[model samples]
Target: MTAAIELHHVTKRFGRRTAVEDLTLTVPIGEVFGLLGHNGAGKSTAIGMMLGQVWPTAGQVRIHGWDVATQRTRALARVGAIFETPAFYEYLSGLRNLEIFSSYTAPVSQRRLAEVLDWVGLTGREHSAVRTYSHGMRARLALAQALLPHPDLLILDEPGEGLDPEGVHELRQMLQRLHRELGLTLLISSHQLGEMEQLCTRIAVLRQGRKVFEGPWDRVQWAEGPIRLEARPFERAVAGLQAVGLVLEAGRDAEGGWVRPAPGITPDQLARWIVEAGFDLLELRRPRQTLEQFYLSLMRPDPQSDSRSDSREVTRRPAAT
Candidate 1:
């Protein structure tokens, strides 16, 4: 099948600075492909160019094999967007905002409006003016609007930004349903790595205007296993991993060590191993590998140490003194 989205050597610049540089990516049809990156990493800029809002300074952007520059409307015809903070006439009811948005594409029917609201769990609240809706409710309305056209490709920018824990959970389930049932090609990005971990099938990491990593989400090198770890003296315990040759990129905490345990290695075993190696175990906790940890590990510099050389140097230092 043809890719849902493709970028070939795509570059974008604003005056003196390049927001996206030499980026090349291809997302397959019906795949929930994630563009992972910190702010200013060109994720939004790349998506904007695809939306025909900003033209790329260099290279090409295509949606469903239709170049955004040449086939602007045709390419966009298959697309739907939900901005970071969507604009709606607050005075209008939830259903009214979605109804107005629907007019941008096809002629709307009352049945279609009701169906979209129900799909997004806003069927009953469809009559409530948008101003009274919570962040999550607003998101549902935005989503309901996006779905009205039955878009072939959906690009959602931080769609879950303001949701509470339960709301976020609900959104995740809804997106999964959209992908599984609707067969919609999705390009969704969010700052919440944990949610992305559960939602996206593939991921791409962008850093400082460049694409650093891209591929299946499962293929990203996490530097450790699946579980998150919290241990007392997390830093020191992480340091101890060196003695045994087990590697982990642990985040430091005053209360303990936070680790994504090595696959096949339990948190307790890691803690016991740390203690056996001559360090007092304050704590060792295992948490899941979030999109945050996966992205962060890609950004961190590797730890390189030569124990033999260090010992020799230390021995020489004492002799010289």
Candidate 2:
């Protein structure tokens, strides 16, 4: 079956600098795929190429089996994107703005327009002038406009930017509902790792325009469990843990020390050792690894480690193109 989106060894260059290098990726249908990287990591360039706004220097990008380079309209007909800050006439009502934008694409019925507004929770505010709308409301309006085409794929670039916690929550819920109800394929690029962790099924991490890691969310490799150990008489607990060679190094969290057990040494064993040493084993459990930890490790790998040599500094671009 044709992938929902595919990039075959794609590369994009601007002047002497390459924005994206030898990128090859595929987003399966019905998947929430995340494109992640620090600023100037070529995320915007890749998205531009995928949307056929920027021509690639080498390789091909396809959407629903249509080549974006040569078949932009046909390919893009099935795709809706918010490539940057969504723009609408500030003087116009939300409904009027959508009506104007929809006219440029395909004619959408008024009923369908109402449905889209309702889907984005903008039903009552449809008649409100965009100048009066909050950032969250504008985002919802942008989403409503994207849905006007009834697209099979939605590409959102930092859709949650500037949203309050509640607004972000609402947007997440709305996207999840759309994915469930319409089987929509989402290609999202964002700095919000926490939100991406909550939304995406698969991810690709980029650095210096190169893809360093790509895989399902559950497949990220972790070296040590973030096992937390809380015990009475903290100094003794720390000493006992180090003496047994279980605590490799102190972790950043304040509440408990992390354990790096020797071979065949398990959490149960460590707890036993702590208890046998006469310290109260208050708590012992491996907390779930967060995406931030994984992302940091991938972006800034230790020089002493041989695991990943491709990791680089995570910094924003001086100026984005």
lDDT of each: 0.76, 0.81
Worst 10 residues of 1 by lDDT: 312-321
- Residue 39 C-alpha lDDT in model 2: 95
lDDT of 1: 0.76
lDDT of 2 at 5: 93
In angstroms, the error of model 1 at 85 is: 1.0
What tens-digit string does per-residue lDDT give for candidate 2 at 119-203?
8888898888999998888998999998899899999988888889998898889889879899999999999999998898888
lDDT of 1 by residue, 221-319 (tens): 233343344445556667677455565455644543355444466666876787777666654433335566666656554455432112110011101
TM-score of each: 0.73, 0.76
